[model samples]
Target: MKRIISQCSKELSQFKRDRLTLALAFLLPLITLFIFGFAIRLEAKNIPLVIQDYDRSPISQRYVAKLFATNQFIFVPWSVNDSVEIALDRAIAKAGIIIPPEFSRRIAAGNIADVQVLVDGTDSNNARVIKNSIKATTNDFMQSEGLIPETNLLTTRSRLWFNPARQESLYIVPGVYAVVLWIFPSLLSAIAMVREKERQTILQVYASSMTSTELILGKGLAYLIVSLGIALVVMGIGAIVFRLSFAGDPTPLLVAIPIYLWASVMFGTMLGTRTTNQNAAVQGVALVGFLTALLLSGFIYPLSNIPFPLSLLPNVIPARYFIEITRDAYVRGTGWIGVWFAELMIFAIGMFFFNVARRVLSKMQLTE
Candidate 1:
């Protein structure tokens, strides 16, 4: 215990004096948190739309007004002679609406009025949003104008449950916490280990009275403490900047935060043991930690969308489980019963990381 504390104190003392490392530990993470929080948006908005109105009638004008009123579409000026095809081909507009000359006349004649909507299919997801928005606007126009039959057989009284306002930040920022926390702590710890090798101080540690387990635990503890500080500052800023509030019990997050950070530190330590230089250590953590947390963890995209075989990787990923815990606390609010398994997974992965790092160190001692 005394040796472990001594090692931890040495790490913290060294860490405190290094300005660049301090900035790396604190500054870079805040920057990353803000960048990911404000920048990444899944829901499409402000679609550029071109409109060709041939009817010049009151009803046709009303329909056009309805489309512009919503936050969905912004108008792109189109000449009387120019076709919507030209705008689409130029990539100027993502969608185009053509109201035929007989638009109002067809309604009066009891015929179905077709409003042709041309959407750019370059991005399949954006194209789908444009199509759905146009369809929904048309349906709303018919209902408001008494064009559709008032009678309905079955309808969904649908309500957006957790996020009624559909604010993208609410869904995005919490996940940003997971990614930011995972990347920085691991990188910091990994670099700390590799730095010893670069400075040749690791030779003294190899010949020291400290066992592999003691040395690993002491270093891991120091970084874990630093990570907690990072977590608080980053998450507090996220709460203020994004206007995030807990929807359910906060207990799950409290329990999971330390476990997740320890796992991240341990994982970095493992990479540090495997690599001889700081550059190699950083690349290893970025490739393994950043890539998995960002892509495979369902932070931006759904895990289901990830193809099979690769999908199996998330089961062992600490960030994958931590994100589940965070999103649950901030968005879903399901509490311990809902996310207990995820927290357990984080703890299990952390142990696995610590074991790998210890065994590697023990092997190194024997080899030396």
Candidate 2:
């Protein structure tokens, strides 16, 4: 017990002394959190809209006025020669609203009126939002003017389940858990173990009375505690700055986080065991762990959209499972039953990496 405590204390002291690791563990994550939290916006607002009203009627003018009155769209100047396609192609407008000469005539005769909407489909999400906003606005105008009878229309009062306001920050901020979990612990463990090899101190540890399991645990525990502290700080930032809510029971998060941290630490220990150089360890952590988490963990992009063979790659990535668990816990407010499979998978992966690292260290000790 005393030896394990000493080993833990030694690792903590060494971590404090190494300025680079300290910065990587603490500072880099906070900077990234701020950047992603404040800068990345998913909601489309104030879209440039081009209006072509051939109908010189009061009704057409009223419709145009209603559309421009909302914050969702800004009317851009349009000329008679400028076609909807031309306006969209030239990037002068995201969407073009064309009112025909018969728009008021058809409405006055109690007949259906058609309005042409030309939208740039380059960005699908933005296009969808624009279309929905236009549909809602038009419906509201029609209802108010008695153009569309309330009895004839079926209204859907859409209650957004998890995020009521449909704020993008709510969707994004919770993902910080997966990002921080991937970067900090892995980098810290990799650098710490590789530093030992670089300084030829690993030999001294192997020769000491401390068993390999004790050595691994002592180092792993120190980083695990630090990583949890970082996670708490990040959660606070998410709650305070981004207004992220934790509506669910925290039991799943509490259960999953330590296991996920262990998996990351074990994976890092494996990387450090395989590589003898600190530069190579750092690079490996960046390429294998950090980049993989960022790209394939379903953090920024949906896994379904990724093409086959490549899509299967995320199954092996620990961050992928952890991100799902986080979203389930933080966003959907799902309980242990919802996340139990992912927790089991994380534990399995952690044990696999821990065994591999143990074997590699044992082999290295024998060679020495």
Candidate 3:
């Protein structure tokens, strides 16, 4: 037990001595929390809508005025009576409201008064919010005007699945688990390996009785154990301190720990295979970490919200899969059945990378 403590202590000392790495490990998650918390807001608020009131009637103007009067929407004056196409082409509006000449007459005669709303489908999230807001406002108009009774109105009670309240923190905090784990193990192993190699201490290890596999296991396990500890600490802080709920069974999350650590360790080993210095290794890990966690992990933005083939990007990114799994467990109370696929994928990819890294490391002379 003392020897194990001594080994871990030495590893921790080595970790603390890398000032850049230690700072990144401690600071990045907090920085990311602030950025994602404030900057990446998913809730669509005060979406701009353009008006093309062609009817020139008091009733039509009243409807248009009511739509803008709501704090939920901002009205940009667009008197494009002749050409709404031109307004849409100029990108001067997200949505355009068109009231026809017969609009007032239809409303007075107890007929269905339909106003055309053209939305810029380019920004789908904005479009969705605008559409729902319009529908809600119009429904209110119908009720107040006695077009329908309060109880007899054709009403749809919309409920958001999974995240019912649509708490952004619930979506984001679980994702941090993946990003945090992805960073530490790679950063630790890469820096540790590069430091020894740069200082020429690695050659002494080769002179010893340790095989390549034995050396990698010793180094990778040491980093993995430390990284896993940091991950759990972050999870606890996010849950207990931040009040972010881990709604699922604790067992699945515990099961995923090995998967996360192994993936990070293997990725770090791969980085170490290519890098000759600690700086290069750290930079490589950062680059990969940013791309995988920040851009593709379905953390900062929803995968469904992106356009074209770019939306498919998260599928290939391992961090994204793990993030999805963690979020499901954290926010939705999903069990092992929900997360097993992600665990398997992480294991498979981690094993593949480790084998490749091991083979490459075997060929290289540590003395070189």
Q: Choose the strongest candidate by TM-score.
A: 1
Order the candidate numbers by lDDT, best to worst. Answer: 1, 2, 3
Q: 1-368, model 2: which lDDT tens digit per residue?
A: 77778888999998888887778887888888888877777678889999999997998999998998888899899896778889899898999999998999999998889999989999998999999999989988998798766685666777778867677776676676787777788888988888889899988988877777778888888888878877877777667887766768878878888899889998898899899898999899999888888889888889998899899998888888887787877678877878888889889999998998888888888787
Tens-place lDDT digits, model 1, residues 1-368 = 99989999999999999999999999999999888887787888888999999998999999999998878899999986999999999999999999899998998999988888899999998899888888898899889989878888877688888888988887788888999999999999999998988998887988877799999999999999999999999999889988899989998999999999999999999999999999999999889899999998989988999888988998988888888888889888999999999988999889999999999999987776
Maximum-lDDT candidate: 1
TM per candidate: 0.98, 0.89, 0.78
Question: Candidate 3's error at 185, in angstroms?
Answer: 3.2
Error of 1 at 242 (Å): 1.0
Q: Count the backbone clashes (under 3 Å) in each candidate.
A: 0, 0, 0
Candidate 3 backbone collisions, by pair: none
RMSD of candidate 2 to the truth, in angstroms, is: 2.5
The digit string of per-residue lDDT tens for model 3 on 1-368 reads 44344444666778777787776666666566556544666677777777776677887776777787777778777666456666777887677777777888888898887788888788887788889889888877767667776685566878776888777778767777777778777777777777777988768666765566766776777777777777766676667755776686868778877777887887888788778997799889888766767787777777877788878776666787788677877788778878888888778878887887777677775534
Q: Of the pair 2 and 3, which is ahead by lDDT?
A: 2
lDDT of each: 0.91, 0.84, 0.75
Which of candidates 1 and 3 is the stronger one according to lDDT? 1
